[model samples]
Target: MSIRQPVSVKFILTEQTKQQILTEQRRQIEQLTAEMDQIEQQGKLALEQAMTQGGSAAQEVRQQIEQERNQRMEQREQLIQQIQQIQQIQQLELGTELQNMTVETMVDVNVGDDWGMVLMGSEIIIKDGIVHEIRRGGQPV
Candidate 1:
């Protein structure tokens, strides 16, 4: 039997091949740089257009938003004033109701209690059946 040997080959670059590869790499880099520059220029143009053409629109929107906020604040203030007026009316009604009640006596429930029974004058103020402010002997208590 006869044995055959296979041939092995090695590749090497000459100066021309090396220069060709470098030129291709430089061309690719230049192409990519040109593409990036074009994209940046387009972005700048778009931004300038938006700032110039849409400026008045943006200002109008901002003014509308501010006006709405002021309106809401005014409404809230009016509502708060109405609530205060209502509370004042309620207090007056409570005072009138208390004035109608008559206290028969001011007896001390406990003999040695620190808080003795309070004496009510001719006029008194009450809310929810609880005495809040009172006048004793024509003086506020």
Candidate 2:
């Protein structure tokens, strides 16, 4: 997997791609919700027409309306799930806290090396996302 660190190691997260996708999804849900009202109206009209026709026709229309409502509910649930997933991904993407250094803005990158060292007041040895060892000034790594 790619870590998505900054190329200059002096940047922060400012990408709007994920956010933009989330916005689009929200817009879609809104549109679907608006359309759901129309679906309900159509179902009502179909049922009323069937009632005038009597017997099996009315029953069939009822079943069809129920099925259509179920389908719309399922679609709404799926949209809700997708929105939740996108929110989770966005949170995970923003979760990294770089306490030692601050980068104003950055991009996603893959660090090929397994181990890295940063010399502050101490020699900080890091592997993966964990700080393994911190040797103070004048101490060997």
Candidate 3:
């Protein structure tokens, strides 16, 4: 990616941070999917009610329901785009192991090591005086 204006940063790479970001993005995607499903159910219920009523009022309600469903579909599409963006960021993060030294910032960040980047919305935790344990994450092959 390209930065609008270049600024130097130092970044630290960690497995936990990557997983956290992926989890959050997945949560948002799930939430959006649920909302879309709800919208479909609501539209169906409205149409069903209008059908049972059967008249000019029913016609008007049907038209309104169709309009509302269209709007909800648009919202779902936007949510899908958001999920794609998150996936793109995830891939970018995985491609490079950011450790230290200087490089122009690709995006906004709250980096905590000599810091090339932590990207926006990421945090680095500091434990108060204890044994620091660093090891590989995930299951054994």
Tens digits of per-residue lDDT for model 2, 1-141 = 333332112112224545665888889888778777887899889889999999799899888878877887788889899899777667754434223352332222346532342222333443333555544332544
Which stretches of candidate 3 lie above 4 Å from their native place?
1-14, 93-141
lDDT of the candidates, in the order given = 0.45, 0.59, 0.52
Backbone clashes under 3 angstroms, per model: 0, 7, 7
Clashes of 1: 0
Model 2 quality (TM-score): 0.53
Please give each candidate's TM-score: 0.29, 0.53, 0.44
RMSD of 2: 12.9
Where does candidate 3 have its weakest 10-residue lDDT segment?
132-141
Q: Which stretches of model 1 miss by more than 4 angstroms? A: 1-53, 94-141
Tell me how candidate 2 scores on lDDT: 0.59
